[model samples]
Target: MEIVLLEDVKALGKKGQIVKVNDGYARNFILPKKLGVEATSKNLNDLKLQKANAAKVAAEQLAAAKELAEQIEKVSVTLKMKAGEGGKAFGSISSKEIAAAAADQLKLDIDKKKLVLPEPIKTFGNHEVPVKLHKDVIAKLTVKVTEA
Candidate 1:
């Protein structure tokens, strides 16, 4: 039996996909769980429309992310930390701190996980940080760490 998947099903298919499965499985499991529907002519047409709509939404989101990346790349964020006379910080700064600083300074809400810090910063200086805006979009941010 042919069915249209409403959501991703392990070992079967992804959302909006038309797949052929055993009639018993389709009737007993997929339909009952609201994961899929019978692939009738009407349902097939609806699936096509749904896929198109999803693609359009995804494209718009990608464009927005790209624009955000460009804006982020153009700005430099400064962080004030307590440091010693030799320019060594009293405490290390992590990605979470940087993310919070970016949000507080730039008014942009960025996730800490998206801040790519290979190692904690322990000195006062200027550094370049990489922020992942999207899977295909990344921005290099300039951060200036000053002694407070």
Candidate 2:
């Protein structure tokens, strides 16, 4: 029997996929659990429409991410840190601090988790930070750390 999966099944296939299984298994486990439905004409048409809608939504999100990436690339955030002897900072600047500083100075709602920092900022100088706006888009943000 051919079935259209509503959700992913590790043993079978992914969601919105059509797979063939034993008739008894389809009637007993899959149908009773509502994990899949019989692949009729109506169900197949509904799946096509759903896939189209999902593609449209994904494209929209990608476009928005690209636009935000352009805006983020043009802006820079300045941070102040307490300096110790011989041009050294007292503490390191974290992604949380960068997010807060961007919010306060540039009015940008940047997620701290998206900021890819190999290491915390510990020096008092100009640094380039990569902001992962989307899976395909990455923006470089200039961070100028000055001694306070």
Candidate 3:
């Protein structure tokens, strides 16, 4: 029997995949558990439609990510911190603070998790930070740290 997987089945196939299985297995296990449905003509048409819709949505998301990356590249976030003796920063700046500063300075609501801070900002100077807006899009942002 040919079945279209509604959800992933370990060792069998992934979701939206068409696999051939034994009649007993399809009727007893797959159908009854709702893990898959028999691949009828109507079911195959539905799968085709679903795949087309998914592609469209994915393309839209990629375009939006690219646009955000461009805007992020043009932005420069300034962060103020207190410096102690010998011009040493009291506390290092983190991704959370960068996100907050971006929101305040540029009016961009960026998620902290998307900001890549390989090391904490510990000195007062200009630094370039990488922002991951999407899987394929990365933007360099200028961050200026100054004494408060």
Best by lDDT: 2
List pairs with backbone clashes in candidate 2: none
Kindly list the per-residue Cα lDDT of model 2 for residues 91-111, writing each as its tens digit. Answer: 999999999999999999999
How far in Å is the alpha carbon of 50 misplaced in model 2? Answer: 0.7
Q: Residue 58: error of model 2 in Å?
A: 0.5
Ranking by lDDT: 2, 3, 1
For model 3, how does the per-residue alpha-carbon lDDT over 56-132 read when each residue is reduced to its tens digit? 99999889999998998887999999999988898999999999999999999999899889888999999999989
Candidates ranked by TM-score:
2, 3, 1
Candidate 1 lDDT score at position 21: 97
lDDT of 1: 0.90
TM-score of each: 0.90, 0.97, 0.94
lDDT of each: 0.90, 0.94, 0.93
Per-residue lDDT tens digits for candidate 1, residues 1-148, read 9999999999899988889999999989999999999999999999898889998999998999999998899898898889776766898788888888989999988899998899988888999999888888989988898988
On a 0 to 100 scale, what is the lDDT of residue 30 in model 1? 99
